[model samples]
Target: MWELQEVPGRSKILIHTANYSADVQGCIGIGSNLAPGGWWVTQSRKAMQQLRELLPPEFDLTITHYVPEYP
Candidate 1:
Protein backbone atom coordinates (compact mmCIF):
# COMPACT_ATOMS: atom_id res chain seq x y z
CA MET A 1 0.00 0.00 0.00
CA TRP A 2 3.03 2.24 -0.13
CA GLU A 3 3.69 4.80 -2.82
CA LEU A 4 6.51 7.05 -4.09
CA GLN A 5 6.74 10.02 -6.38
CA GLU A 6 9.54 12.18 -7.78
CA VAL A 7 8.05 15.62 -8.04
CA PRO A 8 9.80 17.78 -10.58
CA GLY A 9 11.03 20.34 -8.04
CA ARG A 10 12.08 17.85 -5.40
CA SER A 11 15.74 17.08 -4.75
CA LYS A 12 15.41 14.19 -2.32
CA ILE A 13 13.67 10.81 -2.33
CA LEU A 14 10.07 10.05 -1.40
CA ILE A 15 8.76 6.80 -0.03
CA HIS A 16 5.22 6.06 1.18
CA THR A 17 4.69 3.28 3.66
CA ALA A 18 1.56 1.16 4.02
CA ASN A 19 2.07 1.14 7.74
CA TYR A 20 -0.22 4.12 7.86
CA SER A 21 -3.35 5.32 6.20
CA ALA A 22 -3.40 7.35 2.97
CA ASP A 23 -0.60 5.16 1.72
CA VAL A 24 -2.31 4.81 -1.62
CA GLN A 25 -3.84 8.21 -1.84
CA GLY A 26 -3.38 9.91 -5.23
CA CYS A 27 -1.42 6.87 -6.26
CA ILE A 28 -3.72 5.85 -9.04
CA GLY A 29 -2.83 9.06 -10.81
CA ILE A 30 0.71 7.78 -11.12
CA GLY A 31 -0.52 5.43 -13.81
CA SER A 32 -1.47 8.37 -15.97
CA ASN A 33 1.90 9.92 -15.20
CA LEU A 34 4.10 6.93 -15.92
CA ALA A 35 2.43 4.72 -18.47
CA PRO A 36 -0.82 3.08 -19.49
CA GLY A 37 -1.78 1.47 -16.20
CA GLY A 38 1.46 0.32 -14.64
CA TRP A 39 0.41 0.94 -11.07
CA TRP A 40 -0.04 -2.13 -8.92
CA VAL A 41 -0.59 -3.00 -5.28
CA THR A 42 1.53 -5.01 -2.87
CA GLN A 43 -0.03 -6.94 -0.04
CA SER A 44 3.06 -8.53 1.44
CA ARG A 45 5.74 -6.91 3.56
CA LYS A 46 8.42 -8.83 1.65
CA ALA A 47 7.22 -7.28 -1.58
CA MET A 48 7.38 -3.87 -0.01
CA GLN A 49 10.85 -4.61 1.22
CA GLN A 50 11.95 -5.55 -2.26
CA LEU A 51 10.57 -2.32 -3.59
CA ARG A 52 12.40 -0.38 -0.88
CA GLU A 53 15.61 -2.12 -1.77
CA LEU A 54 15.35 -1.92 -5.54
CA LEU A 55 13.79 1.48 -6.20
CA PRO A 56 16.51 3.91 -5.05
CA PRO A 57 19.16 2.66 -7.49
CA GLU A 58 16.67 2.93 -10.30
CA PHE A 59 15.90 6.57 -9.73
CA ASP A 60 17.00 9.61 -7.72
CA LEU A 61 14.30 8.76 -5.17
CA THR A 62 14.26 9.99 -1.58
CA ILE A 63 12.76 8.26 1.41
CA THR A 64 10.31 10.60 3.11
CA HIS A 65 10.69 10.47 6.86
CA TYR A 66 7.53 9.74 8.82
CA VAL A 67 7.87 11.57 12.09
CA PRO A 68 6.23 9.49 14.80
CA GLU A 69 4.82 12.64 16.36
CA TYR A 70 3.03 13.66 13.18
CA PRO A 71 1.06 10.46 12.83
Candidate 2:
Protein backbone atom coordinates (compact mmCIF):
# COMPACT_ATOMS: atom_id res chain seq x y z
CA MET A 1 0.00 0.00 0.00
CA TRP A 2 2.82 2.38 0.80
CA GLU A 3 4.74 1.65 -2.37
CA LEU A 4 1.76 2.74 -4.46
CA GLN A 5 2.20 6.47 -4.00
CA GLU A 6 4.43 8.27 -6.50
CA VAL A 7 4.98 11.98 -6.19
CA PRO A 8 7.77 14.28 -7.36
CA GLY A 9 10.31 15.76 -5.01
CA ARG A 10 9.60 12.81 -2.74
CA SER A 11 11.80 9.99 -1.61
CA LYS A 12 11.62 6.59 -3.30
CA ILE A 13 10.70 4.23 -0.51
CA LEU A 14 7.67 2.61 1.10
CA ILE A 15 6.24 2.10 4.58
CA HIS A 16 3.34 -0.09 5.70
CA THR A 17 0.86 0.08 8.60
CA ALA A 18 -2.03 -2.06 9.76
CA ASN A 19 -5.21 -1.54 11.81
CA TYR A 20 -7.69 -4.43 11.90
CA SER A 21 -10.08 -3.76 14.74
CA ALA A 22 -12.95 -5.80 13.26
CA ASP A 23 -14.40 -2.41 12.41
CA VAL A 24 -12.15 -0.27 10.24
CA GLN A 25 -8.60 0.45 9.07
CA GLY A 26 -6.77 3.69 9.78
CA CYS A 27 -4.33 5.79 7.74
CA ILE A 28 -2.36 9.04 8.00
CA GLY A 29 -0.13 11.38 5.99
CA ILE A 30 3.22 12.74 7.05
CA GLY A 31 5.99 14.99 5.74
CA SER A 32 9.49 16.21 6.37
CA ASN A 33 9.94 19.59 8.00
CA LEU A 34 13.42 18.68 6.95
CA ALA A 35 12.38 17.93 3.34
CA PRO A 36 10.17 19.67 0.79
CA GLY A 37 7.40 17.09 0.19
CA GLY A 38 5.58 15.86 3.24
CA TRP A 39 5.11 12.13 3.86
CA TRP A 40 1.85 10.26 3.31
CA VAL A 41 1.05 6.99 5.03
CA THR A 42 -1.14 4.78 7.24
CA GLN A 43 0.58 3.27 10.26
CA SER A 44 0.63 2.57 13.99
CA ARG A 45 2.19 4.82 16.63
CA LYS A 46 5.14 2.50 16.94
CA ALA A 47 5.41 2.49 13.19
CA MET A 48 5.23 6.29 13.27
CA GLN A 49 8.05 6.34 15.76
CA GLN A 50 9.99 4.13 13.39
CA LEU A 51 9.33 6.58 10.58
CA ARG A 52 10.45 9.48 12.71
CA GLU A 53 13.67 7.70 13.34
CA LEU A 54 14.08 6.63 9.71
CA LEU A 55 13.37 10.12 8.41
CA PRO A 56 15.85 12.89 8.66
CA PRO A 57 16.11 14.66 11.98
CA GLU A 58 14.18 17.65 10.58
CA PHE A 59 11.26 16.14 8.73
CA ASP A 60 7.58 17.03 9.29
CA LEU A 61 4.43 15.04 8.66
CA THR A 62 0.66 14.93 9.04
CA ILE A 63 -1.33 11.94 10.23
CA THR A 64 -4.99 10.94 10.25
CA HIS A 65 -4.10 9.33 13.58
CA TYR A 66 -7.45 7.57 13.99
CA VAL A 67 -9.82 6.77 11.15
CA PRO A 68 -9.16 5.71 7.61
CA GLU A 69 -10.96 7.46 4.78
CA TYR A 70 -13.36 5.52 2.64
CA PRO A 71 -14.62 6.38 -0.79
Question: Per-residue lDDT tens digits of candidate 1, residues 15-59?
Answer: 443432355443321121222444344443554566666666455
lDDT of 2 by residue, 1-71 (tens): 24424444555444444333322233323322322343332345466577766677444444344776969
Q: Per model, how many backbone clashes are there?
A: 3, 13
Candidate 1: lDDT of 55?
64
Candidate 1 wrong stretches, greater than 4 Å: 1-15, 19-23, 28-42, 57-71
In candidate 1 the C-alpha lDDT for residue 1 amounts to 31
Candidate achieving the largest TM-score: 1
TM-scores of the models, in the order given: 0.28, 0.24
2 in model 2: Cα distance from truth in Å? Answer: 15
Candidate 2 at 5: error in angstroms? Answer: 14
lDDT, model 2: 0.43
